[model samples]
Target: MAGRSCRNSIPVAFLVAVLFVLNPPTGVKSDSSDHRYKTNEDVPLYANKVGPFHNPSETYRYFDLPFCSPAHVKEKKEALGEVLNGDRLVVAPYNLEFLSNKDSEIVCQKKLSKEEVAQFRNAVAKDYYFQMYYDDLPLWGFLGKVDKEGKADPSEYKYYLFKHLHFEIAYNKDRVIEINARTDSNALVDITEDKEVDVDFMYSVKWKETDIPFEKRMDKFQSSSLPHHLEIHWFSIINSCVTVLLLTGFLATILMRVLKNDFVKYAHDEEAADDQEESGWKYIHGDVFRYPKYKSLLAASLGSGSQLFTLTIFIFILALVGVFYPYNRGALFTALVVVYALTSGIAGYTAASFYCQLEGTNWVRNLLLTGGLFCGPLLLTFCFLNTVAIAYSATAALPFGTIVVIFLIWALVTSPLLVLGGIAGKNSKAEFQAPCRTTKYPREIPPLPWYRGTLPQMAMAGFLPFSAIYIELYYIFASVWGHRIYTIYSILFIVFIILIIVTAFITVALTYFQLAAEDHEWWWRSFLCGGSTGLFIYGYCLYYYYARSDMSGFMQTSFFFGYMACVCYGFFLMLGTVGFRAALFFVRHIYRSIKCE
Candidate 1:
């Protein structure tokens, strides 16, 4: 045992030593961009794989997609994201570097199928926008070898973003135009070698009909780089790790303190939680579950939205970590639907297994309904929309067939596990055996009544943070599905992680505040806590469309429609996530109270 442990330590120590010696990952000295988001400095593999191709269609694997934020002067981007409705919003940051292929053939070899080619051409002809599906565009999207995170081996072939455009002199500048193309003084460099430039250079074209010959032909040589936000870097990882560890530690401490407190357990006693048990819900005998009966449906919906908000964060985080990766294009929304669909077992099993010590329940229908209602609609909806995109030749079709394949996998893979979990959750007697126990007799849960219940309180909790972010959301959906050259993917990625943490904290704090104000029945309102943030996003999108953007053409109008589609979908997603989470809280509240063991 000692020898084996020593052997393991040797490898660990060796690895750490190597990392330290590297100091930086690559040999390239830090440039302006590398200072913020570091890039590996070694030359990537130069050759493209050729001949005897088995799975040619594998070139479009969703998992293999690469994206980066467009390069800007940095200052300009911060201003864009910080303005307008930002109270409840969490924004994504941008990335701003690009690399080139050693041999252009690597990208060229990534051939598209007949159908895809047809789709692209037809979509363009029909005035339909073919959004870049997954990572690459139909033709130009496959710029080079990919260089996403966790796959940085120097020798292996990887897709790279073309940082520089080689200006091919169609009419020879030296002979035809009577100027030197390569020289700094006279003409634009017509070279075969690709050089780095910012993506902004495309829009920031500084040419004129009448400029001096010295400057006109080859004046400014600012690096023309493109954006790729698919990868996360060392600094981001380090920053996130440090912050997440500290936050997690602090929250864990608070949870422990709350759990250990005698008053808290007593406050959660039985009758106080379960005065109105419906028999159908009895498998969860000690468990309590109730919606906040607000004065109106809108108010109740707000509380439900809070639930959706928190859950959305969870789903997005999972997607961000490459859990689903390129395998599914609609990973965020897809994950949401699936998680909500199977919550009944989790909720019921949690309540029944814990409150009555019954993890195995006879009420499979209840669990199915809980999870099914949420999951079924989303799958069907996406399937429908995906079909439309295909018909219209929209590149945004997002590997719809692939999505169906993955969904089927999830159903086959996850359904049984959920069912099994529910069975065990219902049958378990662990709660009774556990040394920890809840206090007996129901304490009067300070009567807010349904109208005065926790729903209103929950809706308010997440509203402000959501407001802070709505502006940011509008730009994102616009850029992704919209044809605008999205250049700030790195910033967007960082902002995404930050938003999740910020939103969750804001929601939790608000929910706690409402409860402390003697609103004991906060079941549905909890979801409202995080969910109400989306409304702020919707408002900002409208504002941007009206004020900031120049939507004069058909493309602009179409983009507007696409943006609206995303927002509406996003709204329902938020609403569903909030509802699901509140349902969990309600179940937890009741389970803790109803326990007699």
Candidate 2:
């Protein structure tokens, strides 16, 4: 046992080392850590992407919509996370120097042809917004606006583009503290005509000193574009805590009153043992530990779930420690991809060991299933979304090179580690240790009431857990689907723990009820009971889509539903595994206490 423990520790230690080495504990940032600047030094401004106000994910390159560029345009190389976040940083035409101010400088003069005018008109009509970054601080502004002047008549509407930009840069000593991009409505140019028109782009820069420190500059952007509704966030947390307390109260009844009575009745009264066995859960002790059907699939699902659980915990920890920030491009997604690839060993070991315990022989097939269980579905969904992005010429479409790099990472790093872990697990395989002996002939299960059926039990079991965290789901959905920033990592971590506890307690209670009814098939039932929360979550997603959000059109709609499906599936696997493990522990403890012949 000592030797086996030591061997298991080796893989864990190596994983930790690799994680720290690959990704040092640095907060996500776009620029160098040094903030001091020399006088008259060039402050490079990078143009990012533009999209309609309603659809956050549907974005195009800054240069895609007829934006003026430098004569010798240079592309800024971005990190993996940045690319995944659809950030395409390119050098802008405007020239600004540190501590230098300019007045009404002409950026460029353009002759708008018929096509150019139409493109501008369409963009303005859709309420397009553009994004840019100066020294890693982001700026957003509308490309144009529609003037109705409170008139309902379509003929009374006029479209105009802002041709002048005013940049206000705040500096503290030698460091840039903050930057703001403002457009004056008086500087608007009429683009309602199709005739050839000469347009002049003008910009002015003002440098002002500020008392704010450079280190505290990010605090301004930390507040989300939308309201945080912090009181509601706390309300959700308190709601989940109350649900957990309620479930805990029920679990306490089972452990203290019900299970205690059963243990006493079986142990103290040997004379009535056989009679007692004829009635409740004690009757199914012989078959309760029977190896479930499709054990390989069950094992693989559990393995993947374990990995996801670990990944989620670690990600939140990282977020709490400031390794990931809401404004840091795609840092969270990048960490997810990298860490998941590295932790394939966990999945392999878990699946292989559990499958061996179930007396499964096809190691290779089990290994394949474990590896592809989550990644396969995610890859397919991403590919489909990428195809749509390509068709729409959106920035969300990943370049071919990035795709190849990801494939290489998986093939070279993830697959090999998974195989190694599988080999280790196979070498250290052990038999399943069930306290109750199984009879050669399977015991007959009695017919159950409609209310006691698996489907009803699953629904009942799932609803409690879902209710605990349903409120939190709104904030999560808003952050992902809208413009809100999720900065409450500590609250999220607390809610996560609550979710697991609620899922476990509810599943265990249901498993006891199922066994009490003489239904020994509790393995998958417990899992489904816990995982049914995902179904409710998906249902809520539908409600949120139709009633809560303004998201529409094919690209945004497909992207929302498709990605959400994958997310819910992950929840299913993760919570299901939690349920199964808790029920297994409960069964083993109770059965071991009672006399099982």
Candidate 3:
């Protein structure tokens, strides 16, 4: 405990010094601090060149996905109007292993296949069936083949039906090809028997020249236009605001249940010790000081929140650092996966230590739970989602070998750190103490009028704040990971900072108001303070579905992924803010109780 106290003192002192220097308390600047497109009233449909795709003099490169089938290549290329001859034309590659959106792959290199023509043909046709999951059917799947130049599995070959070749047609240009077998279709679901596959080879039917269209684009999340992003960001921001307020008030009601029974007076047998204690906050210092009733729950939440916050910050920083090079497309996730694996030490250490001390559960259970609760879920999500992508010939999918290596690293490196951190955290001192206080007996205070205890006023306080911003948030998540176009990340960065700050402050203020009003259940109220951000985000998504976005046939599975991601992000941010403030409140109350002034 002495060591823990020492560690905390240095950090607390450092934080206070930093806060004094920066004056961070008031709040961050509003959303407009960095928006390129000003005002929700006017949203421009398009912008001039800023990045690589808009740049001329670009080269067509080969995709390097392993296990690409030669047959699919021939069929796809012929559909692109390749005139078999000495004439050479740019074509996407068969194996698109490690290419980015900016770098196109060469998919038409000739190759041999030993697998039976019929069996292989059927497998190719039924690739979707090759991969399946509970309640999660794949939209599409394909059996890919790599070059077998130096191989013993030889087989009879069939001559090319037509000279195969294809080129990635960018969307902003006019159609330059005709009379080709276009197999392109953005089918979100598999085997929509009633609905015909509308095949079109033109730009509208494809994703960034690569076969794996939905890999890195945030569009799958937002509208492809700046106006759309702005619109949705605001919507989601508002939704979250409302959620924050509602939750803040809700939690207040729950916590105030303590007030319902005159908790300070009735619940304490420690009253006999009150005389030995100092004067201030003496009534219920021991038990009511931090409300130990939910320490287990609180610790779990803080663990998850810290993990998510760290992960998000890392991703944003990586983006700022240009890790997602134009030439390096789907590799963003690869980088993130590595960073995440490496950072498991932080997650494990933080969660294990915090949980062990707070929950007082077995240290081993605490450590394992901390590791698995976070890193484990991420790993599983990656595997399942990437498996689906691989089946659909989305070369961005992570390979089995990579997954295996990641797990090995996790076991070797992270598990140990988590165990140690748990031990250290368990031994740590509580950051704040409930002020020393004692009372001979409890005091009963009668409930105030209904208005004083009503949940309505606190709930209303969040509406304006929430209304102000859900649209903005909706577009950001959509734009970032939904495979949508987002050039104005600078603007997005501004809006994101503003939204979070506003959410935190507004929620806190609402909680304070309810407490003053004598409705003291602050737990859920604290959670809802930030939780409202989701409401605005989801609302913005709804608006896009109606007003801005035109992605009609996105599969149910995609919807599920999108929604789930939103919930996880929303809750994590909300709880982090709540936990931080509550910890602060605990400290303040403790000190006040001790002074008894």
Q: Which candidate tops lDDT? A: 2
Higher-lDDT candidate of 1 and 2: 2
- Give the winner by TM-score: 1 or 2: 2
Per-candidate TM equals: 0.40, 0.93, 0.50
Best by TM-score: 2
Taking all chains together, the TM-score of candidate 1 against the true structure is: 0.40
Supply every candidate's count of residue pairs whose N, Cα or C atoms clash at under 3 angstroms: 77, 0, 93
Q: Candidate 2 on 104-153: residue-level lDDT in tens? A: 99999998888888898889888899888887777889988899889799
Residue-wise C-alpha lDDT for candidate 1, range 1-597, written one tens digit per residue: 999989866733543333223222221112332222223222111111111111111112121122222243122111111111010111112111222112211111223344433333322222221011101101112232223357566334232233222211111211111111111122111111233322211101111123234222221211111222223233444555465556656755674475445245444543465664432222322222222343223222332233344444444444344333221223333444444433323443443343233222334554454344434555565566555545543333445344565567457744664566546756665743322232343334444455344456444544544543443465465444333333333444555555555455545544444444444344445555555555556565677666755444333344454445555545644543444444445335534543434
RMSD in angstroms, candidate 1? 18.0
Residue-level lDDT tens digits of model 3 in 1-597:
999989856733543343223221211111222212221222111100111121111111122212223434321111000111001112222221111122223333333233333333333232211211100101112232223355555343221111222223222111111111122223111211223222211211221323333223223322334575566555654565566557656665764664433335433434555455332223334323334345545554555566566655655655554443321233343444445554555655555555554446665665656666655565566566555545543333434555565567567756665556556666664343335442444333346566543255334433444455544545454454333344445455555555555556555555544444434345545655555455445555566555654333223244334545545554444444443455347435433533342
Candidate 3 vs. true structure, TM-score: 0.50
RMSD of 3: 16.4
